[model samples]
Target: MNKRFIKGTMAALVSMLATNAFAATEVTVYTAFESDILAKYKNAFEKTNPDIEINWVRDSTGIMTAKLLAEKNNPQAEVVWGLAGSSMALLKEEGILKTYSPKGLDELRSELNDPQSTQAWYGNDAFFNAICFNEIVAQQQNLPKPTSWEDLTKPVYKGHIAMPNPASSGTGYMQVSAWLQSMGDNQGWAYMKDLHSNIAHYTHSGSKPCVQAGMGEVAIGISMASRGAKLKTQGAPLDVITPAGIGWESEAVGIVKVSDAAKRVVDWSISKEANELYVEMYPVVGHKDVEASVANFPNVQQKMAKMDFARMGNERADVLKTWSDKFDGKSEAK
Candidate 1:
């Protein structure tokens, strides 16, 4: 071959390699993680993979799930980073989730992994129900600190409480379901009936009830303990109470179908670096031995009720409907 021809071939190969290396891959991620933590998660991911940019669409769990379901036919999200496991199960049932187990998946607890053939979603961390009591407000109102779920039903707490609405918040439904599972259906209903009389409001956002309590809008707020602890650490004068028995949900991740871009994102999501980031925010990571605590997180993990994720997903719709029929749209005092 002529020298010029050989040089041209070498240059073509070099250009091809350069083009592949410089190609930017962007992934669209839909998540339910709080807005405050979005920047941190995004920045950490970007720091390691500068070539890939993450476009996050964050919202409350219900709204995010509904959006994903609505877009099922023509999926947009490449991956779901932090969402309720139950919501992912619903999506999996609809065949919208792509089953690709991430690296270090075996390190996760068995119960946290997907059992079905497709293995639709993976667990990141567990979030449980707890109460946020405004100590100052509770004392001023002469209210007794709540020690158990039943304590919230006392006549003393009447018209001084807030909780998430089951119809709108995943945490809300989980609490109701946990009660039914723990207290038995009949007793649970009875308990809720009594507790309902005291509820000041039913919030649409799962984390807002605690936020409202942290702000002293209500003397007591029923919400996720993680949010409560985080708030309390921020000088909210909020006392996070993990009643004797509490409901829990896992923050989960899943790859959305219909995107080659999403597959790539999921591939990295299950890697060691990604799990490390998850551990920073959530103490209970699925991959075994990645246990680390967030500041101000109490030893509430030991108190969590044994969750039945399969049953929860199977009966979620019925449970929500029953809860709505029984409590939603009803007038309550604040």
Candidate 2:
């Protein structure tokens, strides 16, 4: 609570926070961004804030969310960057996140602002569920193309599908959350039970299923639309199918208020330059004027569910538990 401490004591995340002889302040940042982009983000941010350096602690969305909740009393991270908005909402609900309005907040889409704590969190981009159908594998196996969520449950697709485990992935959680919201809880649970029968295995990483599908390891992969689109462009004989309507979540940022440097990072996270970086991988960004685009990615602006991130955050624990109990048997070796 006291902010009088020097470099190493402010945010509780600085293993190397320094004010000694021009040493840069190290801001501890927890993130779930894909591994390839971490260095780019760090380099760009440090270039802009030469006095402050980022100390990144990265993990999957579910792991990051659990870690933040676990460390709420003595938070190890000063900021959370590029995690699911629903996960950010959970942190906000637990009061693990601190409030700070960024510099370019007005330039971002109003709808991307968190309904629960606008000052605490804002989205950078959206990622939604998609079906990765391997044409080569399907042709070999005589599988019919699946066009909807229900189509995934047919006997023909049994033991041929791969998906992420919700307990370990935000994409998995959003898919489950979306089904419950769209199909109603009773039907949703029933739907999962049926779908579980067709699943060959569940992956730990949200990106893995599509990668596996692209490699012909699995005929179908329940994975993110962004990953699917990228794989398709790379000449993977895969169909990146965005279902008629599907679940989506924004990768968002929030502050932990351990130091002024943390606030600076949050500010940079929402800037126009940041949006430009985000849009290179994600087709939709918080910045309204950025005109986000992804090559070979389908138009999904109208297909996203009216997600209630607050509700998803609030219900996360219960939902994960139920999902694990019902479906963890099929998960790949962690």
Candidate 3:
């Protein structure tokens, strides 16, 4: 072969290898999923698309939402994997999310998808407020198991309650919002006032309250149902309880307007595999066809009230402010 031709062939080989090396896509995902489930979700997605790598930033729903909103102009996240729909709605309202409906949108519950023509988000799963009672502590204290939301306000439970604060936690905010809608605004605030007196502390993360209760830091925690059930299965002396009425919100996913890779990820987010993964964690998945077990909160479907999506979105800030003014600085800070 001619020396120049041989050299050109070698160069072509190197260029080809470099192009292949740079072909893999990296999607930056912001999420509010628990620390334990993060790895599993990442692994599952990577397994199916080995060429695509996920860079995840995980935190509580409220914190994640705040972080995303702060970075709106020079947005950092490629996609949001698991966040509150209410938070997503707020982002959509701000026009930060890219308008793209995934392929599986028709399969999801109508209430879970974005209302606008350019759908900004899609729901994955839901979580609701529940009670976590430390059976050992309750037995020792000779405490009776409370079956209603109002039962936690009893004087006997003073300094033995923990719950998330609405200002900083989506789960907390949803529960409060649900109560106000269900019991009427005036009565809900009155009920919360009575309940606040018994609370030991208001946690930063919604599920932290239940974990604290399970660990015996507090006798009871008002938190989401799944977290309490998982803690109990881990041998925490806790029993997960869903009261007669509770507020619920769906975990959702959306594409940030900043990246093409994010748009691709969002396009894939509502596929059958993602739906299956969601059902594994949440019984009432975004898709009605999917079924899974939720051992702790029985009949979870029946317990979820008719939530007004628009109403929640509109009143979120005001409701949170009202809650803060009424209850903030009242609990002992940890």
- Top-lDDT structure, candidate number: 2
Tell how far residue 224 is off in model 3, in angstroms: 2.7
Compose the digit string of candidate 2's lDDT tens values, residues 249-273.
9889989855789889988998988
Residue ranges of candidate 2 with Cα displaced over 4 Å: 1-26, 258-260
TM-score of each: 0.79, 0.83, 0.80
Compose the digit string of candidate 1's lDDT tens values, residues 1-334. Answer: 7999999999999999999999768888999987987888778777777777889999988789889999989988878978887788888887778778665667677666566766878777777788999999999999999888888989999989999998777878888888888888899899999999999889988899999999989999899788998998899998888876688888778888545556556656666666777787777777676778677676776777766666777787888888888888653333
* Model 3 Cα lDDT, one tens digit per residue, 48-158: 777788899998776888899899899888798788787788888876787876766787887777766778888888777788999899988878898888888888899
**Candidate 1's TM-score:** 0.79
lDDT of 3 at 255: 84
Clashing pairs in 3: none
Residue range with the least summed lDDT across 10 consecutive positions in model 3: 293-302
